[model samples]
Target: MAVMTSQALWDFGRGSGVVALVLLTLSMVLGIATRSGRPAPWLPRFAVAETHRNTSLLATVFLVLHVGLLLFDPYAQLRIFDLVFPFVGNYRPFWQGLGTVALDLMIALVVTSLLRTRIGLRTWRGIHWAAYGLWPIALVHALGTGTDSFSAWFLVLAIVCVAAVLGALGWRLSARFTERRAVAPTMEVRV
Candidate 1:
């Protein structure tokens, strides 16, 4: 593990990681908002989509910063390459690889999002759906590699994040089922 300096507390890279956390939270919230149910035909779908893109891009930016700080933090004995490559980091290969996987997913999300307009909607949506997987991998990495991983304060924070994610997912799935049920009756009547 690398040594920590009191003066190193305010490094830009660390700041970036904090910024990333804030962006990720906002992104998750916005994702839930847009995914809850179908908006009216007059609703501004483009705005919701743009907000989603901006939040995702912002989160990606912070992910880069988080990786930068982690490599230099010294406490984790990570290298710059470890940030990009999975499963080959010097310390805690199994857990550290989680971070690498998360990073790669983040990068993939960004790339796919940037090309979303060029790609067809279905293809874009399919690739973007992978963010769900990336989100939990990231949470796991934080629990395993983060400096405050097991701290009481961080524990509460992690719990809240996890709960929010699960609750949102549940709400969305329930809403989908309700919509399907409602439509099924209408279709049967038409038949």
Candidate 2:
């Protein structure tokens, strides 16, 4: 019987991490688009919101798998403590810590979202804001800790993710501005 090395597990962890990140990016993009009430040719706003929710749940699963694989991989040297606490990992502490922070944020968002009704809208929304902060932390963690961080494919993926988020943000801001402008004229003195 041939024995599999931890390297294989490490690779699986990395691949899943990438998938999780991509799914997260897609979820965020769809969420922002849904909020803007912009309907794509193929999908309605409700569909986009549904897709966003589904993608986020999927990302959560993959992220859990990613963390599990890494924690079990001997080469990763990741302790259980490292999963929740930031800046405590023995290897590449800063990068691993960033991942931990992202994980924490993800957990908060998921928990609050799931219990949104019980928690109340204001509280849920407050915690859910952490989801927005998770993206950059996860991105930095991936870039700093992954072996393929400097690879062309990873660079390309990073660019695409960044662009997607920035585009969504721009759209959201522009929509708010347009709404304000429309209301501004209405609010002006009417004789």
Candidate 3:
């Protein structure tokens, strides 16, 4: 691996990108399942929720590897700080900011989630919703930052991935935030 040729390194980078895509898909599925109210039959609610958390963790790992490889690939010329700070990457600042935004949102989601039991329930719920915003920024990062953005195949795949994740989120929101669940009847109307 250390002595690999440029082409080999390039191939490895591309493979990591593919892995990131798959991990993102799995994370989205597990997130939806967790939010859909305790998994039935096969999985206990706790297990499903843990599984979803673990999946998101893996997706974060894949994201690191993906970005690291891209920075090394010569084509991207990305700096390390670009990962954490928005609009710092020289190659494509506006588009790259999308990735930075996603990273920040993901971090916020993970931190709030890990400390959920310690935080106020309402605060935890609000912070956890950052995952929804994270998803789209990530999708846009893939499209705006990738050289393959214009390819017919890439477009179709991006559309499919975005649609699936968002569709599942919609389903989860419907179940978790139903009218009755989200709203409490007031004893008296606000003056």
lDDT of 3 by residue, 68-126 (tens): 77778665667778878898788789888897888788778878878988997899988
Better of 1 and 2 by lDDT: 2
Give the count of colliding residue pairs in each prediction. Answer: 1, 0, 0
Worst 10 residues of 1 by lDDT: 177-186
RMSD of each: 6.2, 5.4, 6.8
For residue 175, give model 2's deviation from the true position in Å.
5.1
Candidate 1 regions exceeding 4 Å error are 1-19, 36-48, 175-191
- The estimated TM-scores of all candidates read 0.75, 0.89, 0.75
Alpha-carbon lDDT, every model: 0.70, 0.88, 0.74
Q: For model 3, where is the 10-residue window of minimal lDDT?
A: 175-184
In model 2, the clashing pairs are none
Which residue pairs show backbone clashes in model 1?
2-74
Identify the runs in model 2 with alpha carbons over 4 angstroms from their true place. Answer: 1-3, 175-191
